[model samples]
Target: MGEVLQKRFPDMVALFTGLGFLTVLAELVLMDHREGIRILAPLAAGLGAGAILLGLGFPRGRVWATGLLLLVGGMGLLGLVEHMQEALEASSPSVVRLVDEEGWEYPAYPGPLREGEKEGSPPPLAPLALSGLGLLGALALHARKP
Candidate 1:
């Protein structure tokens, strides 16, 4: 079972790599953000690295897997940064737009005005911290030899 899992894991990673790249590509090209996008480069790099790592599954797959996990952690950190920025923006009206009819419009930010602001913590931070820990574990495992 252990050897079978090891053999199948890389194939799963390859499938996930293809799907993730497509999703990110779609977001980059299609989704329109009210505020300008940030952290595109780091996320892109991570995705690219992951795809390469997934592709290199035939030999030294464990090394590539370690690299893939690191990149995943880096991308998660980027997301945490984004959520923190959102938390800041939640307090103030950072942007204003003028419309011919409405005169001025402020896109709603999460806050006391928005429901559930204080109920729960920012979503990304939890997973991001977990990712960091996982990255560390991956590094330790990579360094250890059987």
Candidate 2:
């Protein structure tokens, strides 16, 4: 039973990491439709998928795992930093004014969505956190092997 579990560990990790990456990609795509945003989602998804494929195809190779972990981890870390910064900025009190095409002026709510105020959504930190955790797990697993 222990041998069986040990043998399946890498496959399970690869599957989960792949799914996590894909989920993050989907979240990024759904959150925004801008071209700039689209670019990152595809890139992240591709890299993540590639990592999974590499893991499955070359289970004995440490290099692929290391490279994939580094890429995904770095991206996730960057996302975490970016989101934290955004969250901090959102928490601050600020007033914003906007003028419409017809020259109508309106006051915009500052920061993330507040209670009973439903116009804008808050920045997504969940994905960043998940990705970061996944990356850390992968790194730890890698370190523990041999």
> Largest TM-score belongs to which candidate?
2
Write one digit per residue (lDDT tens) for candidate 2, span 1-146: 99976877766666777777677667666856336433554575557666666656665755666576667667665666765775676576566989999999998865777685535334656536445635744664475344
Candidate 2 clashing pairs, residues 3+ apart or interchain: none
* lDDT agreement of model 1 with the native: 0.51
Worst 10 residues of 2 by lDDT: 33-42
Q: Model 2, stretches more than 4 Å misplaced?
A: 33-38, 59-62, 95-124, 133-146
TM-score of each candidate structure, all chains considered together: 0.43, 0.61
Error of 1 at 110 (Å): 16
Q: How many collisions per candidate?
A: 0, 0
lDDT of 1 at 126: 40
Which run of 10 residues does model 1 get worst, by summed lDDT? 32-41
Report every candidate's CA lDDT: 0.51, 0.61
The alpha-carbon lDDT assigned to residue 35 of candidate 2 equals: 61
